[model samples]
Target: MKAVLKRCLLGLATFSLVAAASGAGAADPFPQKPITLIVPWAAGGSTDILARVLSEHLTRSLGQPVIVDNKPGASGNIGSAMVARARPDGYTLLVGSMSTHAMNPALMPNMPFRGVEDFTPLGLLAYVTNTMVVNPSVPAHNVKELIAYARANPGKLAYASAGPGSTNHLSAVLFEKMAGVQMLHVPYKGGAPAVVDTVAGQTQLLFSAGTQTLPHVRANKLRLLAVTEAKRSPLLPNVPTVAETVPGYELSVWYGAFGPVGMPPALVTRLNLEINRIMSLPDVKEKMNAIGVETATSTPQQFAAILHRDADRYGKLIRDLGIKGE
Candidate 1:
């Protein structure tokens, strides 16, 4: 009996030692190597710019280099899927947007990864308002005028979008449905061409990010109509929100970071903390403001909730509108 008791005690001590050693190893300072952040969009787009800014800050905070890889295609599906399928280690990250993380899953028929289930939410990086702008030659000066002109012209009035199933396209479609107008949609390879065409008078209107359109607006190439948000954009203080004229109209695009599902909770927490801290820095805030992106920092739980809510919203809209994938 004495020998058996001694053996049992020895086993328990050995098990405890092993557990302690494992815990220590697990908690060792993470991000010992460089991290790769994937931006599922073309270079120079809002998502890419925001990802680059974040990569710079994270490099400083984590004491390791951070690289941005732009993999733009399928309205942000290809790159997003890559991240969704990557290993759950903290090294691989995704810079997700409304199109990649929320709307595409709702609109596309064969989305490989579940927006809410296939990844771990890190935190919101930034949010920006989409602006409604018209070519200088257009007669419309505001939302009301634009609506009237579109109704009068019907199919004659055409608008441009970044691509089919893009947020830019969805925003204009929702406006048409709600405002009871039937303007034409012309999809371009991306926003740069669409905005250029709008400025060149090839297209009449567009709903695009403030950062991208602000320069053209300032150049007097396009006239401001109304922002696609509940509140007026800070960059364009004098401009009114579309809701101000077409009641209840609200839309905005936000960016965030995520990792493959089942990432260690401790790792998630550490990442969320570091990124959120960087987002709130004064320099970061100033740079984002100069580019028309509003700072939005949140806990991982809060970001996850936002993803769920936005996914449901876009899913219903896509179903009702019968939007299909390209």
Candidate 2:
């Protein structure tokens, strides 16, 4: 009996030691299972494409599949809400962008979730500029020409947007306000449709992301006028910036990754490191450049700070403009 009790005690001690070791190794062996990256946009969009690209690289590095799930709607709010409600475990992540984090919050008065509060920033993935494109039939070759024509036409000239409260929408709204024109505003379900309509001549103009608009422009379906970026895009260096004609007119779009609120710092750091590594890859940079997107990386803290700053800036702008969410 004494021998049996001693053996039981030894087994208990061994079990405790194993448990402690496992606990210590928890974060180190992170992502033991496949990770689900939720992109709050339709598949094939720039944000979705970026998520897929990063997922591929993360899969190779972590030896686990990184799946992408696109849940697009509500100006990217529905999918973002799903992420906001997801568990803070490292397994579920969000490919959040300025649309969902900054513009949506600014436009929606009764936003379902707070941009900065609802998520733990993993890292900033990329920053890309948008272009203000019009149909070739519009007779506007540049920003100054477009503004002059818009003024002459008043409400006759129309511009399409992905939706109300979307970055695309507010971009036009701000543009109309600042340029002192009366262009009619048309809203669509997504950026693709807006770009398509603009390309097909159903709409005269739209402010669209480089990825969505560049293909059509290159195909001669849409005309490229001015980029909304602060400077000229490497992809379209000849095209001028809107700021060139309208001083202080700069509206850019950016993409980032985040986890649900309260995500483990260890997991966040790991994700940031992997994503930054992928961004540094030449192939990855090349792919993004082809779509006219400039790749960038940032820490979780830095991303969170950006969200806060943009929220405040856009929120004030939206309020001042009386922009309503769709």
- Index of the highest-TM-score prediction: 1
Please provide, for model 2 over 1-326, each residue's C-alpha lDDT reduced to its tens digit, 9 standing for 90 to 100: 99999999999999999999998886467777898999877897677878899999999999999999998877778888988998898888898888788777767778889887899988888887788999999998899999999988899898999877778887888788778889898899877788888888889999988877877887888888999878888777888999899888877788998889998777788889998999989999999887777888888888888888888877888888788877
Candidate 1 residue lDDT tens string, 1-326: 99999999999999999999999987778787889999987898667878898999899889999999988877778888898999999999999987777888877788878888899999999888789999989998989999999999998899999877778888998899889999899999877899999999999999999888888888888898889877877767889999988898877788999999999898999999988898899988888888889878999999999899888887788888888757
Whole-model lDDT per candidate: 0.88, 0.86
Clashing pairs in 2: none
Clashes of each: 0, 0
Candidate 1 regions with alpha-carbon error over 4 angstroms:
1-20
TM-score of each: 0.89, 0.87
RMSD of each: 3.1, 2.9
- Which residue pairs collide, candidate 1? none
Name the 10 consecutive residues with the lowest summed lDDT in model 2.
23-32
Where in model 2 is the C-alpha error above 4 Å?
Answer: 1-22, 25-28, 200-202
